[model samples]
Target: MSMDVRDLGGRPVIIGAGIAGLMTALQLAPEPVLLLSRSPLGADASSMWAQGGLAASLGDDDDPALHLSDTLAAGDGLCDAQAARRIVYAAPAAIEYLARFGVRFDRTPAGALRLGLEAAHTRRRIVHARGDGSGREVMRALIAAVGSTPTIAVIEGFEARRLAMEDGRIAGVLASGPTGPAFLATARVVLATGGIGGLFHDSTNPLGSCGQGLALAAHAGAVLADLEFIQFHPTALDGPGRPMPLISEAVRGEGAVIVDETGRRFLDGVRGAELAPRDIVARAVWKHLADGHRVFLNVRERPGPEFARQFPTIASACKKAGIDPVRDLMPIRPAQHYHMGGVAVDGSGRTSVTGLWACGEVASTGLHGANRLASNSLTEAVVCARWVAESIAGTPAHRTKPAIASDRPSPDPTTVRPLLSRALGVLRDGEALKAAARALLPPAERKDAASDPAAVGLMIAIAALRRRESRGAHYRTDFPHHAAVARRSEITLEAALAAARELAPVLEGVT
Candidate 1:
């Protein structure tokens, strides 16, 4: 049945004012936009934390076909090729759009977009600004451009609580204010809330990311896809912090190799080796670490100073961790950095929930299937958000109706954290997931954890357990083989929990 998109009133209520949110607002230029940011302007958004350059097919030697192929290969048979092609083909235009918006990407001596390399891409099409600061610069330009555009009404510090739905149609979001909760003037809602940081004990996502949008939508009955497939970068600096610091992919792209404590190159088996898909490399690093030895990354063999000069963020992080890029191999471990799956949406970024849309890390547009290729996060954000803006542009504007109270229960943190830590994060098992659900249940017949932050974490754990066969970021030790049919896994909390309990015995002895 065709959704009555007209009932939505189409003003595009966007949540989380990150780069994706900014781009979405700008793309629909001069429209009355209601941008809800959790923090003040340009504070803790994940896009500002990005270090890898933007991936595109902007070079003469590069094309979208190769970009699509690389993205698909990295996705390990789960990527929608049509979506990949469309997004890849739209790269040059996105870059041109950025250029028009005055994003000063890094230039060569003669000055053209100085494209760099990352894992999976066959060509050097990553456009950057200052070395390892493309996201920051991009945000600066986008923010300035959006601020100048008269129609946008920026309201910072109002974290979105839940989407206000009436009779199964999205009206607006009920958000919290400084004093108390208030109704956001919503016509149509767009979720660009970055990645999920609160789910993992160690993550590269900003602390502001708790997957609230995903949780709210899931609670509201939006069909989520590929919740199992969470991408862990093989090389996040394991250290003290709420969200662990990221080690950029540029290190590997610039020739850093992973070596074990015994000083043997463990990734020697894979073709493309360190540059292989993120899942393979991360697993290889995990396996090496499992042998009671820490895996270390070394760029000393290459021109160390040049590599350091090229990737200062990594160099500084390594240096702070007491490793010198010129002398020692940096101790590294695989940690959750990006989530490839989220609230399932169409090409136009419309979710199963009417009048609601999603873009950025929170929305899975079938672009990054099982695993996301490095640098595609930024590219995907621009591509998808642009589509979302355009799709909403023709949507008729209407005032959000009267607010309705939500029935979804909030979580008690004391129980859910350890439960989530045990089940989800970088490792997984079916048994652990089921146990996590049981252990996390409050004895009070609580409906609370149902909408908990850990609820989405449980969803990821359960979905990972359900797709028993090993594929991409989801490594199933019980079913150690890959499935022939690489279907996108979808589920609800109830179905996911049932599946979780069913296989609890299977994942019993595994972590």
Candidate 2:
């Protein structure tokens, strides 16, 4: 069914109402904009659930250069140095902007912003709000600010299923809302649809985050970079839940330790132990669990009884899981937390596809190379969102009659979650990746927009299989060491599908 796109007007349309989308809308204010959220604002967003604070060089002793250095080191040789530098230099001002939006950050006795430490950082520069509720607080402030802005129109409970293209530029978005399927016409579209963690059985992201943006962009012929590099957080609270609760790295910064069932410290041999880069720490914990040793994050003694006061959110989560951080060791395991890969974008958040932009976890801006620096995801979202908005502001609007695209039902995530979890979770091998790629290929071939999760799953598996060496978060057991030279993988969805077809026979008899 085709609908006229002219009804939706020429206002810029933003998708996914998380930090990135909200920030973009606010930045473009005074210039009319339309914002879309799959769920209610502040709900089901990884931003609100994020416990760690934003990373910025706000301290006198810290500098942007130092922050850039840490980010580069964490990226494991694949980071774009210029992008890292740009984001770090913009950090302090970004924090100030958030403050203007009414975000109350933790402060010191002297009235300066209080900074906390995280892994791989040379200085204490993590700015939080209410200890572990930084993301929630930021979202609360942004959501309130968005409500008062007269130029932004928000539509909640709508899922963007496809991007409508005309003459090779984005023209409109085909979405399914409470009123049923509808198409919104716009000259520009911004995709801030979070990460691909929902494809994993155990993840710290909301189930709705199934890489819809990546799939949409791929179907629109956008180039994707480094899709295999997924960061598995080391300390998600062990439990049976769709979205597992995370024990923020801030707890470790506050003096926690990871121990085995016998209370033996398993990370003692690694330099920096619990404070090591997340990739290193997660891999260590995964090895321990794979070796039949149960792991736990013990903060009962180091941080002591004040644990509840320091991290109220994590404390609450622990209590709900029937454990007290002040007295008991909390069971922990590695779970998929963030993606370092997505539709390739530049400094201004422009994707390879014309008239489309992406920010937050949905865009690979080269800040996070093979792995993301702690607390840097939020920083990238705000910085790139502002740039994207500014870039759009200077452009003239064009009104085109909307052309309708096929509206396919979104695929059930359950069909691909288990396969992805087994093949692309914390640890991976070539055979499993090949099988996953094979299993996911059919959906991509069908051109089913509903199979977005399967499309992204195939991309991740194919990227992981191609990168034969271990680097950062992507560890291939078959290729247990880093490559002699570091390089990144970039491919279009069409090319990936072609490669998948060629490899099908080779993987048929395996397993």
Candidate 3:
């Protein structure tokens, strides 16, 4: 029995009540909106966990051109120049819009906006809210603004299971409420569900960001891009913990270095070195350790007091791991921090499927391209969310349609948990990834290209395999030279599945 709705109260339904989702909801024109939070509004959302400031082009020294150049350079030739320029050009206005919602940005004594720097940034243009607690602070303001709005309704702890499409258009979602799974009213569904980090064995992304949205989008036949370009942050707390704690990039901006076991600066030859793009930094570190992560440093050099001031939270987290940032270098490496690839959405955040829009980390807006520059994800979130809202509000909702009834499965947390952990973590070669993907698929349609996780894995694995040379984060030890020519690797479900099957024989050996 398929259920559908045309009037879900008043406004569109937003999934994953994070900063992007909430901000997009607010930007709608008096639209009665439904925001579903899988956990308490702020707790599980990765938007709240971002430590560095929002990247922008506000300073006199910075301009949209500079920002675009940095973004494209970091993207490793996969970034869409127009999309990058559009987002960068919109930065100041987006930041101001947030300020209107009562985001109290840090101010200097002379009443100037305070800016900070992170890796790949040529100027000090990152606008932060609190000291190293920018995400938390910004999220607090947005959540509060949403709470006060009379038209917006937020339901917490309702984990969305799957999207419900009607006649090939998005109607609503099948979500798990407090009691049971049921069909919910979704006029137009927008997935602000964040990136795929918790899918890995080790990640800085909160446990909730397990690519549930990624899998759900793929399940719903959305096109995903650059799936293999996972960003591993340079300095994660390297002590005894299941998931590593992120040491903010601000520490490096304030003069931290990446050193090896002998305190030798191993990154001396690496371009941009410690300040290099994240993928380069991550691979350099991943080289030290074979299986999962890589190793490097967050050296507490000359500007100890300044580094402490900028990254107190990071300093405190390192202290929890029995390391002192002021005295010793924080032994660190890359853990899966951000996903550069996701369900492909255009500038307006619309997917190939109609009425389905995505923003934040969930949508590959082509703003991040192959690699995201430091602190830019947050900027992209605000800019893209506004664009999504503007496009969605003016468009008329489709005529009343019956809502699709959610297929509520009996609880099986353990099944999904393990399935994601082994197969989807950092570092996948052609063979093991294929096995992992194949093992993860449902038995009936393991070969089905459309929704098979194995097929998805094959797509990503083939991209990684074909690259042959190391450029940015997609490094292949087997083929470790940067090719003279560069091209973006995009695969249709069919093409990816064919490649996966062709390479299945080769990848089988790794597993």
lDDT of 2: 0.89
On residues 157-261, what C-alpha lDDT tens digit does candidate 2 reach at each position? 778888888889998898886677878888799999999878888999998899999988998999999999999999999998769999999889888999999
Candidate number achieving the greatest lDDT relative to the actual structure? 2
Q: Rank the candidates by TM-score, best first.
A: 2, 1, 3
lDDT against true structure, model 3: 0.72
- The local lDDT score (0 to 100) that residue 430 gets in candidate 3 is 47
Question: Cα deviation in Å at residue 112, candidate 1?
Answer: 2.1
Query: Residue by residue across 1-511, what tens digits does model 1's lDDT show?
Result: 1122223344566888888899998888777676778787679799987899689998899888889889998898899888888998997888888988998888989988888888888989888877887888899998898778877767776777777777787777777656466665556889888877666676778755767878778767788889878888888886775577787887788788888878888888898888888888888888778878888888888647686777777777777777787887777888778888988889999988888889999998888888898898898898888889988887776776665434333333444556666676555676776677555433212455434575676677667766878888887776778897899988775665555455445456777
Off by over 4 Å in 3: 1-7, 290-299, 403-428, 442-459, 462-469, 482-485, 491-511
Off by over 4 Å in 2: 1-6, 404-406, 447-450, 506-511
How far out, in Å, is residue 86 in model 1? 0.6
Model 1, residue 462: C-alpha shift (Å): 2.3
Q: Which ten residues in a row have the lowest lDDT in candidate 2?
A: 1-10
The prediction achieving the highest TM-score against the true structure is 2
**Could you estimate the TM-score for every candidate?**
0.91, 0.96, 0.89
| Candidate that beats the other on TM-score, 2 or 3, i.e. the better one | 2
**Candidate 3 structure quality by residue, lDDT tens digits, 1-511:** 0112224653587888778898898888477778878788898888888888788888888898898888898888778888989999888888898888888887899977898878888888888887888998899999888878877877776777677676777766777766666566555778898976655556888865766676567667777777777788867777668567888787677677877766677778998877887777776676656544335565556457666576667767877777776777777766778888878888899988788889899888887876789888888988898889988887787643455554444222234445444544444454555565455434214433223333344455555655556656666555566688766555555555555555444455585
What ranking emerges by lDDT with the best candidate at the front?
A: 2, 1, 3
The lDDT of each candidate is 0.77, 0.89, 0.72
